[model samples]
Target: MRKQQRIKKNEDFQQVFKHGTSFANRQFVVYIYPKKNQTELRLGLSVSKKLGNAVKRNEIKRYVRQAIFELQSELKANVDYVIIARAGATDLNFHETKKSLQHILRIAKCLPKVRNEVK
Candidate 1:
């Protein structure tokens, strides 16, 4: 993801945590905050030191970033999202991580609605 689309500041993360609504599954916790004037979405990730060593933490972050990248089109714009990986997340591979993230996003209502058509 681009730097512009990431939430890097401590204040930004705090704002989201304070004002956003959170949703969680076994693997991930997602906090969603709406930004009315913004045209693009931003993402923040939090992987605790308790989760693993540096290499393992970095790997988990990579999985999350890649999953978010792939789900970009499906995500709602003008919002900020913070994802916190739980202990369960470390065991997941890339595909599993993506699936877990998708599930949490759905619960958080971060994904836009799809129109189903009858053939």
Candidate 2:
């Protein structure tokens, strides 16, 4: 993800946590707030020390970043989203992480709606 597309400031994260709506799955908790008139999505990731030591936390963050980057085109634009990793997340491999992230995004309604192709 680009630096401009990341939510880096502490205040921005706090605002999302404070005012945004959230949804969760086994691996992730997602918070989202709409950004009116914007044309892109901004992402934030939080993997706490309590989830693991440095290596594990960093690994989780990397997995999440990769998943989001891959799915960026399918995500809804003009929104800020924060994804928080949970303890069970460490056991997941890349595919599992991607699946879990997709599940969470689906539950949060952050993904663009899918349409069935006509036969």
Candidate 3:
């Protein structure tokens, strides 16, 4: 994602957390907010050190990115997606984590019903 399009500003995160619509499931919390451009969807991943060491944190971030990539088509355009990983994420296996991600995405109504499971 381009830097300009990405939600890199701290204020943006705060706005999303404070006023934007949110949804949470087992794996991750999805925060969706409309943005200046509706032509693209940008993603943000938040994984804390409390979950584990740097390696584990990076692993979870990677999984989050992969899951989002797999569901790119299902994501609504012109929105910003902030995915916050909870402590439970570090312990879940890959497949289970994917399910958790899909759950939140569906809850956020970001996933298209026509699309099947993302492998």
Candidate 4:
């Protein structure tokens, strides 16, 4: 993700946490807040030191970012999302992390609505 698209400020994460709705699972917690009139989605990631050492934390963050990048087109626009990693997240593989993240996002309604094909 680009710098502009990522929420890097402490205040931004707090704002989202203060005003956003969240959904939690065993591996992650997803917080979301919609920005009115905006056209792009912004993402923030949080993985605390208690979860692991720097290397492990960065790996988890990478997994989450990759999942977001893969699903970028399906994400809702003008929304700010904060994904908080729980302890169990460190033990998950890439596919498991992606699946857990998707489940969290789906519960939080951050992903775009699915459409059925008409053939």
The numbered model that scores best in TM-score is: 1
> Could you give candidate 1's per-residue lDDT for residues 16-106 as a string of tens digits?
9999999999989999999999999999999999999999999999999999999999888899999999999999999999988877787
Per-prediction TM-score, please?
A: 0.92, 0.90, 0.83, 0.91
Q: What does each candidate score in C-alpha RMSD?
A: 2.2, 2.2, 3.4, 2.4
Per-residue C-alpha lDDT of model 2 across residues 57-104, encoded as one tens digit per residue: 999989999999999998988999999999899999999999999888
Q: List the residue pairs that clash in candidate 2.
A: none
Candidate 2 wrongly placed segments (more than 4 Å): 112-119
Question: What residue pairs clash in candidate 4, if any at all?
Answer: none
Residue 54 in candidate 1 has what lDDT?
94
- After TM-score superposition, the amount by which residue 108's alpha carbon in candidate 3 deviates from its true location, in angstroms, is 1.4
Best by lDDT: 1
Model 3 scores a TM of 0.83
Clashes of each: 0, 0, 1, 0
Candidate 4: C-alpha RMSD after superposition: 2.4
Clash pairs, candidate 3, are: 38-78
Off by over 4 Å in 1: 112-119
Error of 1 at 23 (Å): 0.2
RMSD (Cα, Å) of model 1: 2.2
Residue-level error in angstroms, candidate 2, position 11: 0.6
Weakest 10 consecutive residues, lDDT, candidate 3?
Answer: 1-10
